[model samples]
Target: MMFTISVPKPGLVRFSHDRTRCLQKFDRTNSVWSMKMEPKFSHNRKIEELSVELPAQPHPPHLESSRDRALQFNRGQPSDKDLDPDDVFEFGGYVAREAMCDEEYWTAAFLRAETHWEDRNRDRYVESHLRKYTDQEFNEIKKRRNVQFGNKCRCIVAMKKDSKDVKRPVLKSMVGTLDLRTRHLVGGETFPEERVKPSNFGSFRMTRSNRYGYIANLCVSKPARRQGVATNMLHFAIKQAKLDELERVYVHVERKNKTAQDLYKKMGFQMIERATPQLEEKQLYLLCLEI
Candidate 1:
């Protein structure tokens, strides 16, 4: 006789049988387990006993909470929101520092670098848009990135004892910084140079907030592509915004970058606005996260 066994989805089993063995032999084999023919059992029954007495598996180790621990013991590294712009440039090298000085140069470098990446606007912008930036302008932007980093207060880089000579690594090429206008006011008001214009390309605009806050520039570097650097920067920005007790934090997303849209969605941001007459074919979305 043959026995058949069936198992359900996603599993395996093994069995052995002698095909040449007749029914008589099969019956004899089956009877061995229940056989009481022997008057005295001299062989050891140790194997059966040992098999049934299997040792229990050990438990996994417990993890301790570091949140309640003091800042001195904190193992967390600083996020982009927590890092200074000076540090970002410090790690980014001379060109990175140069990018901070001149908006045109920075824009040119950004546009050139962006071409290789997954930008929504592939070849739409003419070469003319790539502006040459001045050293003074770069310094201003650098100052702003740092000021915003301080305002956010998300994380700070701790100096290592052994690595004192080692240069600080750049957190990201493009870091989004947030400025909290609650405690103090930012001086020297200037109109946005690149205003959200009505165009085919999607543009981001500042959202209306009852509470006071400022949105920092979105800084992207050349070497940091497809590594979730931008996403982390956004997270750090949001974290800082929340710590400042803001009602909401919002960002403008370009209509074309679906990848960015997906990330923002995953991070719990929703599209709140559509394109208006002034905005044109370029759709504008106001993504907000609650503190």
Candidate 2:
């Protein structure tokens, strides 16, 4: 004899030949299954046959839309869809955002202090021995940063997002920082009064109104160096400067710092003013980028 069974939905169904047993296991959550059957006979005669029909399988979970995949991939963490597109920039698993809250300000201050501590110290031997700053020193830096921020200086921080922390998903830690501020430029002709023979020089005065953006205190964490964080921060600053209606952006770099000079040059910054040797012991070169 032969028996046939049909299932309306996708599930597991079992059958036995000797006792004509029909066992049905239904699970709404599961859409796939595997089956195994073994027949038994008492008298070594003709064995009974049984057949079962199962519904078609559902679509695979991996074959989802790109948006769905992104949502699923960033389930608990903050995503670009949740942020203001104008304020945040995403690149290379990092986000560059404006420093707003107290935690971000403190982090930016700590980054600046930690990276530029050696430059502040005059004595190289003493600097080499110092590993970190005291709490008072950090607080002082933070205070100075607060004053600058109050004075129209904008600070951008490159943050590495941590998806593991559901409480704080956006800014886990700061990798780099850059500050932008408006600066006034005055340009004209000046003649020395100590000229031995002052000829009939044409009295021509050239004065133009020039206001531009200035970038300063750009630094990245030691561990995050050489990973394009600095480049990304500079790009963000340029975009911000354009939004502020500034036509030119300038940066002052140490004369001996070839690495920084090369980076600025690569980003289309030209040396506008070379440091004068007679003026100061520590000289800096001024570079400008016309946005």
Model 1 lDDT on a 0 to 1 scale? 0.32
Instruction: List the lowest-lDDT window of 10 residues for candidate 2.
Output: 47-56
lDDT of 2 at 100: 46
TM-score of each: 0.37, 0.54
Clashes of each: 14, 0
Q: What lDDT tens digits, residue by residue, belong to model 2 across residues 1-291?
A: 121221123325454463222233434331222233233311111111111111111111232444324322112223444456777777886778676443455456555545545345547553343323323433544454331211235678887765544333222356777677654332221211111222322222211124467777677776677778888888889997786566888776666778888889999999864344421343556678988
Distance from true location, Cα of 5 in model 2, Å: 88
Tell me the tens digit of each residue's lDDT in model 1 across 1-291.
Answer: 111211112212222262211111011111111112233322111100000111111111122334212112112223334334533333322222112112222232232223333233435352223222222333344344332311311221111112335433222222222222221111121111112323322221221233333333333343444445445545555554564446665555566657656766777777655444423434535455656
TM-score of 1: 0.37
